[model samples]
Target: MPALPDPLPDPVAPVVPLGQDPGRAAADRLLGQELRRCREARGLTLRQVAPVIRGSVSKISRLERGESPPRPRDVRALAAFYEVDAQQMRVIERLLEHAQDAEWYEQFSDVTPGFLKRLIQLEGDAEEICVYENLVVPGILQTRAYARHMVRAVMPSAEPEEVDRVVELRAERQLRLMDGPLPRVVALLEESILHRRCGDAQVMHEQLKHLLHAGDTDKVSIRILKMSREWGVTPPYPITHLKFSNGEQSELAYVEHINGANYVTKPRALDDYRNALSNLRNAAASKDESIDLILKAQHRFGDRTAS
Candidate 1:
């Protein structure tokens, strides 16, 4: 029988290198995904990769799932073991460099659930984000007062401090809409959602005003689905579609449920959500019409306060 190729010498976890600054959670995730693909492609399992990387199976699993960052030397060792060429080697190195940075949201780790952490990671790197809101305004476009009302309403039993923390976290996320290279946001809001009394009539009015201002920006497009329209089926879930521009340029659909969230990656499922979003866009009011509707709703809310 022909001799089998020898595996590369066992590796030690290299001194983890750091990036320019924090906020590399997204990069770490992308790198982990690439590592998993390489491992699976070469018919290797977590158990097999652990020894080579000088880690346990769980550690390898975490690295593969982007649950943890990977060391540069560990990445190099895996590349060599997989017989990756010079070009691929460089790619791995690039990913390792990206994976080294800390996440900005790490401070909220105590309050943030793992599922939400994953969502935030994806949100950080998304080039475009599409959100469908059935009840309230999408969090990314919400004003502080509106978001605070939402937090209080949803978690009525939560401590005041916790609610405040949640509101603060939401505010931080909203900054993404303008702070840096903005993610183009396409938000579909049900018409009745504007009328749903959150904090008070004044609160709703102020929120609508905020929405109007946000919609005016070139990066945001808000559309309202009228109540009278014969919309087919109500969306079974709130959908968030994230589109990325760099690396593999992956597209993901985040479906939120009562307890947790589901990430849709299968092509067919993704297509379904994509098509639904397209249909919703067509059925909703145009940009100008949406702005007009929002203005009308704001006036109505203001009227309630006057009376």
Candidate 2:
């Protein structure tokens, strides 16, 4: 079995909380209901709640509705008003943080969307992730040069300043795999990812070197499927699976076109994607041999560059 994560450290990072957009939305609803229960159980009406904290009825209602966050002071006031201790208030506080996550991913609003937040949550909470790619070393394994090239290419029409900012964000997304507290990441790459040229020889070489580094790591595993293999279930899409330590499972799927991304969790859709993933995994080379294939391609390209 893979190494399990250490006991969660009070879980107070305030980073992306443990919910996707829909998950957060539901959490918000529950927090709202709980807030009302706490207040009503103490015989406090909306009017009494407002004056007790010197806020408006509208403000109290808004907090209960999760339309706005409960300020720290507001939480203190309410806890006192409800005759509860600070520890009891913690549950509400944590749930509201999930409501505030900017990481609610959009399918494709472009402009770098929310990759950093999504990446952090996926690594911090997940036990394992299985990823498939068609034409790149997935972001977790990308070198700076390769990442910059891919970022520049991702949104070709963005303003110059916006492009630069996004490239910086992509480069930052590689932290976990390089350092500690990483997830068990298994990747399957199509053979053509090797031959496709994203940048000049220098950047491409960096990418290949980075892939080798990833393969050599004890926990990170990668496999490549040769182009000649006749694979049966083609979803014509890219898919990723993330299994969290909390028993939460999600599929990160995107359309074949650039900029199309969706965190797929509808049961029926997940079933179809899971079937496709199982087939693709079966067709790919094992980690040991995949590294050899990648190294050979690197040598061939390097020879061409040297001559």
Candidate with the greatest lDDT versus the true structure:
1
Compared with the true structure, what per-residue lDDT tens digits does model 1 show for residues 246-277?
65437877776666667666666677777878
- Can you list the residue pairs that collide in candidate 1? none
lDDT of each: 0.76, 0.65
Q: How many residue pairs clash in each candidate?
A: 0, 0
Q: lDDT of model 1 at residue 162? A: 88
Task: Name the lDDT of candidate 1.
Answer: 0.76
Question: What is candidate 2's lDDT per residue for 1-307, written digit by digit as tens?
Answer: 1221121111122224334355555666777777888998888799988887788999889878877655656766677778866776777666655454334333223644444356555554466778888767787777777777787786677787776666555555456344443468788888888878878876777688778887788777888998877855344445667666654444443322344345555565555566666777888988777888888878756754453
**Sliding window of 10 residues with minimal summed lDDT for model 1:** 1-10
lDDT of 2: 0.65
lDDT of 2 at 108: 26
TM-scores for all predictions = 0.67, 0.59
User: Which whole-number lDDT from 0 to 100 does residue 95 have in model 1?
Assistant: 70
Instruction: List the RMSD of every prediction in angstroms.
Output: 15.5, 11.0
